[model samples]
Target: MIHSCPLLRSLTLLLLMAGLTFSCQTRNSSDNTTEQTAALPPAPNFNADSAYAFVARQVAFGPRVPNSAAHVQTGNYLVETLKKYGFTVTEQPFTATTYDGKKLNARNIIGSYNPQASKRIMLASHWDSRPFADADSTQKNSPVPGANDGASGVGVLLEIARVLSQDSTKLSLGVDLVFFDAEDWGNSAVATDAYAGFCLGSQYWAANRHIPNYTAYFGVLLDMVGAKGATFPKEGYSTKNANEVVRNVWTTASQLGYSTYFIDQQGPSITDDHVPVNEIAKFPMIDIIHMQVNNLSQTFFKEWHTTEDDMDTIDPATLKAVGQTLIQVLYNEAQPVI
Candidate 1:
């Protein structure tokens, strides 16, 4: 989740639902065709249990806050694991100044497959958990376990890397899996400048990409995706900045029969890593983040930024829903040779 410190006094709340409807109508007319009924491709076998275990493995490493031993060890684990999965792993180590003037040693890990292919897709998620559970009433100053928030998305991506390694022929396009650090090291709720402290690793990567002049067809960022019961509505910034990308992901989710988890509703604008990717990297990027419409909390999942976001809340089914959808999307993009 991105932070918005001191509140933007001039920013207006953009009602995304209405904007999506209009955009859909325009897209449908321009396409002028019903949804294609291509034979459903073979199901990409994404194992939920394996993904769950990956999440658990990260939690066992303790809180991966930046500048800590746990953070360094976990970063190494990610690099080695991806290398074992047949990816050409690259690590970008940099120092970032946090909102409160703390310099953090952050690493952005990138794993590339089929680097020769010109058509590429990027998938990313932040690996560092927030240092302070500022949102939790009882443990306002304590660090969150971040099982669902931090580890979940990385787990799914790691599992995807594993599958890609087992069957290289399954992927035709180049794929890059990026694990960004220091995303959650941001200002507290009481801070004067919120967004200033967040997404440090991504901000750095956007400015200095792993591969010089690197470009992707599109990118997707996953966050809070392993909650027991999660809903992914179209984020406002995604719709405004990358409407086509959002449509593609939502359509793929629907075709995979995961429509219940990927609802058609529009969520509020979020200040996630995708924002910098879209604005700076110039990639049309979308965010698959958990949001609850009926819940009283408007921003994110229930245990967001709380100590309760531990391993107990990491549900395998939710991981499966997200991982399978991502696999299906990638497979759909794979063009078979004539």
Candidate 2:
């Protein structure tokens, strides 16, 4: 998440209930009427251990700071891991100038399943760790470990890729697992540009997609999703831009009995990678990020952007909830025509 004192201060608290009801609109030729119905599909088992291991591996590389050796190694590792899982991988490499006016080498790694299919689903997460632990008073200048913030989402996606590779027959729509870099480099506190630095890789990818004229049925971004007792309230921008997608995902989570983790409440909007994907790419996307109420940090998770955000803070149960919910959503999606 992007952090600015003003943005955090401007958070509007709103809450809404998330129920387990699936609605589908059916149009009738007579009188141009429409009807809605509900349906539930069986979901595959998501292994929490596997997802946990992936997060651990990323953290083991040390902080994935942009232009750092750890960042390059982590990027290569992600690309190779996806390829191992039978995904057609593509790397979008570019240079981005941070808010502090430092040019950094960034890459957006994409793993595609069923590359021939036109209808697709995009799952995204940032793979870069923050350069500074700004939120931690003890080590404000130290780099964040980013196990939960940066690696958690990617770890879940990697596990999803592994699960999907085991059985492509479960899904009809193609899938793209995107790992964006340089997402944590922005400082809303001092940046003069409204949209610069943060989410640099996503902004670039959205403006210049790997495939020409690329589009997706919908996209889901996972951010800071593996903290113990984490809660994911519906983010403001998601409701404003992709309310239907948000509903579908929340409903799916509820049906799977993960309502506690996937809270049915409206949350404050924050700057995230999905912002650029929605605005620049013009795609419907929702972020499944952790959120907290009445917190001094004004962050979703307790260890956000801090040195404490390490493997010790990771929880397998949280990973399982999110991973299982995503698997169900993908498997239940209708086949869109190519």
lDDT of each: 0.88, 0.87
Model 1 agreement with the true structure over 123-154: per-residue lDDT tens digits: 99999999989889988888888998889999
For candidate 1, the TM-score is: 0.86
Error of 2 at 151 (Å): 0.3
Model 2, 2-51: lDDT tens digits are: 22354454333211111211112222332132111134555568999999
Which ten contiguous residues of candidate 2 have the minimum total lDDT? 14-23
What clash pairs does model 1 have?
5-194
